[model samples]
Target: MRELLRSAVAAGACALLAGALAPATAFADPTVTIEGYSTDVRAEAVSALVAERGLGTASAEALLRTQEAATSALDAALAQLGDSAAGGYLDESGAPVVNVVNESAATSVEGVTTRLVTRTTAELESARDELEALPQVSHTAIAVDPVTNQVVVTVGEAVIGAAGTAGLLAAAERMGDTVRIEHVAGGFEPAIYGGEAITGGGSRCSAGFNVNSGGQDYIVDAGHCTAAVSQWNVGPSVDASFPGDDYGLIRNDTGSAPGAVSLYDGSVQEIASASDAHVGQSICKSGSTTGLTCGTVEATNVTVNYPQGAVHELVQTSASAGSGDSGGALFAGSVGLGITSGMGEDSSFFQPLTEALGAYGVRLN
Candidate 1:
């Protein structure tokens, strides 16, 4: 994987920084063709799909095309359906599945499969808010699961017998079946250190994306990492937001870098644009620790309460990530999606890229 480009003249300082800095090198020349998917599909991502989903190369390419189509269709459907649209996701065959509150609402959305559900997205979000108002506890996460038409609360095994968990469980029970509690081993934490990529403050985090605003360049990353490390090997921290939101920006002093992510497989995936991720959309994450991992979006509008603080409006995915993967790229094909934030027991969480870009007033480079 390509480390953050640094100035070679700072060799002495680089040595002093040791593990926190690496000698700078040029990024690989951007390549377009990868396994006959033209420039749209990444080879490493295709391999991941083949291995994880047990699909052939041709089948994986077709799925990628389908996912791209579903993304566009979902965007239009959501805009047209408005509040009546419960939620939308991609099915197992990469087809768009939209949930509507009633038959009338269903008729408004076309070019996608629509299912009538009992609850609207607004209702489920209200339930999530109620759960968040409860006594905040560690090792727990709350998210709206559109597939089940309920709010899912994930409690870590470490807190199952703890006092705080009892109150949480009681509240969930009182809420009835609208709240689903699932147990898993281990707690959620920001992925920092223990991997090689972007480094500062003796910690390592993956660089998210190269962005620009007002002719100035910056790199977006996990807020928790930027909050702790003011200076990075590439540049200094410019802005950061943690606790409620996990996103930050670092000044990019090394001139313009390509709008692409390293696949850690001797190639890179060119990022063409940015978009919001929908539930069930096939996506991939590139991190220093795990390289490139692929999976579907499990949930959106998620709230993960880490030991540090509660992070809201996160997207949960089945993609795998670990320490040092914080601030890595979460994308689908050439479209940018999110910045790696943390990991739960069985799922990974990301800060939505659209929100970060809007907050920073930066556009993809």
Candidate 2:
């Protein structure tokens, strides 16, 4: 693959996240297309990896090749193999690595290799379900970390005053060592305030990715934003969900929803599809208040315990975000990764774009 066109690895890549409009033309079901050499996506991916993960420029470029190849191997394995197929990850060497529960499953994908785990991906998910049974500990979060091969539970000051902290500890203990607990500082909170993305319901939130549902254009954001206020900049918030999930969609009454995301540098990245954030992957976020920032995805399928309630399937990252960033865009290159849901100093959380799009029956325009 051609090395990324001049590596713009500086933090300058991030800017105020601006929402994109999906084209009015017919849309197709979004598919995973591993980036190829010399492609625009390859450069973006390289730039993101270097900027966010602190990978050396040459190392980042090489790793992209490995990542793409691993993705290809994963697709073939899932298609040729059966349900035993779990998922894959990128190793320290930037080689695509696959994981499987069944020993008989394909152990290697082209140039990549695989690792064996005792539990199937489904079984691991079942293990992760134990978090739902635990008491709600404020300022706490849980996520499935493939890198650690376990569910990680994070706690902070939010639990000090609550009895739920003990309850959480007991639950984690019962779940065994597969549940990893770590303490962090500060509490997770939504980054919405008096700024404007579209105003209604007495507050404002940054807009997420633009999507098309039932042939109409709409913008998505954190469900809490929708719950607080129904009036949106483009139109009224027609749908929203919180606690169980954190996603909301607003009707785009305006014409021409472009399928692009603002780069904060007078340029924009064309969004092709909504994708789930993977651990170790570089991600960029844009909000009206914070403008733009980049970071590495630390975990996925995280459950965040908010003061109001629990929001499931959130993605955690090291990105810096603040007030007015909620519902902002979390993306990788042109692929929509997640919607900025909430954050703390060390880490921020987001609603996975794939789940949000699926839940709302919408696709990126």
Candidate 3:
């Protein structure tokens, strides 16, 4: 089965700690408190999957197993790709699928299934470069969907009618079906809110996770949000990376940032540690507007072109979240998942917590 470390209840959901892998925050400020994601939130998502994706409980459990088994090996899988293996993911059928360039690489692994693809990842990367060069390509995101063995380009409907869009479409056409274009109704934007109510800048953003860097307590969030304001509900902005990356670190001067995520239902989940997300893994998002929503990771290493600029290395999931959710917590049970970055009705994306931690030299509180 897929494995990180061990397994345990995340918040109250059936989900496991990203690894089975919390603490009480010293709250001197009454406004600063930890909220947990509700157990019902996961129930809702699972129900939707049953109704919409023909998903069953058995399928869900199987997917979780495959996810645990493959996660640790995924990095090695990529490293050892023999010009054939494009990538891998778990399918709705609860089958672990991997893309291979040749038959020799198609052998079944412990928890994996395989498929053959004609194009190599390098070739898809070249197509992506071509698409990125187009001027009308704003409001779009692209990633390699290993399940489909193709480069999927998601665009906002607003750009569908733009004159420059034609060039993008032409590039996709030239790719001979290797490039798939999908349209989203609302264009993607950073969901930063007026931070004032949350003890942040006028722009609002959800607190990602409480972290400690070099013995300093801080709250992690979207750089775009942090770039706009210097103070958070509990403290001041100390370190951040934006434009280049999308995380901001706020120093806790008065109180400690909690090692938990709000459930919005008056509970909090302990964050054991930070971890990277994988395609097909079930994930939950905690945002101010939408609260907590869960879905499976549909894509990884996604690059989003928001109105503000481009943000890369995002994890794309089927979970739906919106406005004022920027820098919100994205987690799996007890494992620290991600920080909310952007979203659409059908999909949402996050900046992985592992990267955020590494970039800021921090660890989960």
Candidate 4:
């Protein structure tokens, strides 16, 4: 666990880091109304898009609207296509792209572009499962790539020349083209410590979302963080799941848990609902170490082998996060998506909010 508040020195360091990472627009108003949407969008979220994608404010807002609409269409197509639906994602232009094994089923998916793929999602997932069952390889991540119709395996530089790497490579080779191996620069580890948002047991982590279960309020966060810290500044850890999954719940004893995410600015984004992440969807995350950052979703149902243990069903994103960012909120507009888990050299991983909510029998407050 990355504890920070136990010692004055650690607390001071966290404060300084938070100050350094705080955005210049922290004092500005948080919400803005975008055309064609019923709810207001967070101003800080728009700024994050402008910074990361080099898009104008209006364009960023429009892109968000497009992605939201696409998400709805994706849900409908997935429900209709069922077994025929291989996978779906947003395109660079923010249009939904649905992959289907049966070309006939693709015809039924309207309002979205559809492509014919050789393998179904189940097949790709099976391949991913086989790789995960292998001897745990540190610094490695695996996910199903529907666009390529294959299981993509990413190995970090730390284990590039190790014996385990050689063995893993051999195993992948035997699996043939079903698995695609790619090497990256750094290893994946849980991002913990030196955070400002929430503190407990000398460790620090950002809150994911405010939830309600059986009339009791709770704050959800990364399991690894809660598992290490039993007591939090906001509440106490009541339930946690890690290794196999990364999610936890802390009772909101303070009676002030809001269904909003800090923009790292003075204002916060009000999250009205939660949704599953789709690859290629534009998203943002807020953390004590990096403030608010925006990027595109790269993959979902990802499996990462960390030094502590293997975490499954994580959503991978191109968003940037750093130490002290663990358990931060990952969202698109007002819709919650995931809880920050860890990162590799070029990618960050998050525990899906939907799964976490299911596991805890909670709903957004």
Candidate 5:
């Protein structure tokens, strides 16, 4: 009886041990958790690593997976988890829009009570100016996750298009890449236009509009416009319109300013109200073909080569802007901002409102 009892007890112990040794289901789902001061902090960290560590997309992705693994391990060890590391997962849109909150906090998780931020390719513009000031890094391209303050940095060839590549390299060199300084090959081009109304029948050219700066409203147009083409009026009675660029400025001998760039359906967006069009702002344009399409700004200060000559310092975006959108008003919530100019088929690009304001010497009021 004693031996049987002993054997039974031993079997029970073995069963308990086996159950303990079984794999936990917690790691079955791949989850990413980020902890930091803000989304921008994590994003900037990731961007800087991409530029400095000579990491590629695959490597970066792998790092994300590793981060998940670390979170799982940490979760297993913690008595209570805090805010699930304050992050969201990537969805079908290649974006992390859904956030998981309401997580409980415990003493073990208290150290990681920070926010995780994500970023996309669009936020690259904001980082451009900062990264440009660096030296060891020759170029840097920053794209932001439109939903969050997350920023991604792609160094060298990894930088999308010319502007992005330049942005990353410039930033990396500033930090000084002594280990792996891979040279970027080939040149990159910026997108032409982010909005469109122009059709096949309309002639294709770039255009710009007037802008306000330092209390002066100035005539702003595409650089491609001929200097000889000057005489112009404000309303209707117009002879020849310039489509050489997306937006153009009309010289008013009588001092009458044009009302605004109007869409074919009669929707009008004021152009003078734009002080500075931000990086992620949604913009609409009126052009010859599609008429009044809208999209977001991807980047700015991108230089591209037009068939005529190399046009430098252009705006870039992922908005599906096409012909006729050029010379059209780019509006943010009915506020006039950027002018439609051109597209490179991949992305839409524009000129800055500041330059437009500088040319006219008038206030946008």
Candidate 6:
């Protein structure tokens, strides 16, 4: 009786194995999916049998049910292939892995996306902090014309109300204490405007530039410089504008001489037509306060408001600016960015080169 029962069991197992190996007429394609997205190709069913067996019985049983269903479907597809030798099964420990040739591979997207977002956020925050630490000012000033299209930042006691001077001080205080500030006493040389010594106890003033309006010349300088100058020393040939209009010209030079525009330390660039500026150009500057500095044009036609008033329509650049650096020049290497008008930390502002030309009528070299 026992032998008969054993023989019957063997026959049943053999019949089931034969059914699984039987060839079918239609060979259905396997679907590959990653992150819920489907791919058009064949795929093999792989079961992950963890040796640790840390999962509870209920979870393990659920996993087993899923594995069996996937395996049965894969087997059905394989049987229809017609060629039994093309694919086979792989055994890793007790886990049965079905290997299907020419299967489409899917990428692990969730892990990659998480990493990219984390890195981008970190980089943006770092850049913002760096920008906020740069030098900036709260002062305002008028633009005077010494040569053509130049701005001046008064220093010393006159710097109290001087537009360019006040703006410079505000920017400087933002920087670290490593930088030192000083003033050039006893006037050096007058270039565009007329003055013996600017920033003195008497009618104090600093250098500036001239914008050629038609045939006339209009002086531009740091608006703050005018507050320091109690009386106008401009010439018989020059007219004046202030506060709302930061542009003016040399109308007189009685005992004093007309100021010129300084280029480098002691060098100067001849003013031609002030309309020779374009986007993406380079520029250099020289100032009684900051001396000479160079940078590139960042933008044009920028308007900025200050405590004194608002100066509209100016140029901007990445040029480094500090106290006394206001009313300088923004140049394209040899070209010009206009004149140093205002600054924010490391960034500096300039009057429009075209505006200067339109206001005065002089050419920029």
lDDT of 2 by residue, 9-95 (tens): 111121122334222111111242335321333444555566566777577656654654454555566556556656566565555
Best by lDDT: 4
lDDT of 6 at 260: 38
Per-residue lDDT of candidate 6, residues 1-365 (tens digit): 33432221221110001111111111123332322111110010111122223434334333433433333443444354323212222122212232222322112211110111111222322332332233322232222211111122223332355344543555544433322243423211111233334322232232345443444433454444444453443422243333343443332222222233443222344333243332223344545444444444444433344444445555555455544544444433223336556565344666655565456555432
Per-residue lDDT for 277 in model 5? Answer: 43
State the lDDT at 240 in candidate 1.
88
Q: Model 4, 334-359: lDDT tens per residue?
A: 78899999988989999999999998
Worst 10 residues of 3 by lDDT: 14-23
- Cα RMSD to the true fold for all candidates: 5.4, 8.6, 9.2, 5.0, 24.3, 36.3
lDDT assessment of candidate 4? 0.77
Using alpha carbons, what is the TM-score of model 4?
0.87
- Taking the candidates one at a time, how many backbone clashes does each contain? 0, 11, 28, 3, 88, 65
Q: How many clashing pairs does model 3 include?
A: 28
**TM-score of each model, in listed order:** 0.87, 0.80, 0.82, 0.87, 0.41, 0.38
Ranking by lDDT: 4, 1, 3, 2, 5, 6
Tens digit per residue, CA lDDT, model 5, 1-365? 33432221221110001111111112211333332111222232234334434555345434443443333333343324323332222222122222223323322333223233332222333454354343322222333332353433324333346443454455546543221233333223322333221222112323334333453333444433222233312211112222223334533222322435434332233443554444433344444344444444554445343433334355665554554344444554334556555564445556666556544455553
- Model 4 residue 242 CA deviation (Å) reads 0.8
CA deviation > 4 Å runs, candidate 3: 1-45, 58-62, 73-76, 93-95, 108-110, 160-163, 194-200
Superior candidate under lDDT, 3 versus 5: 3
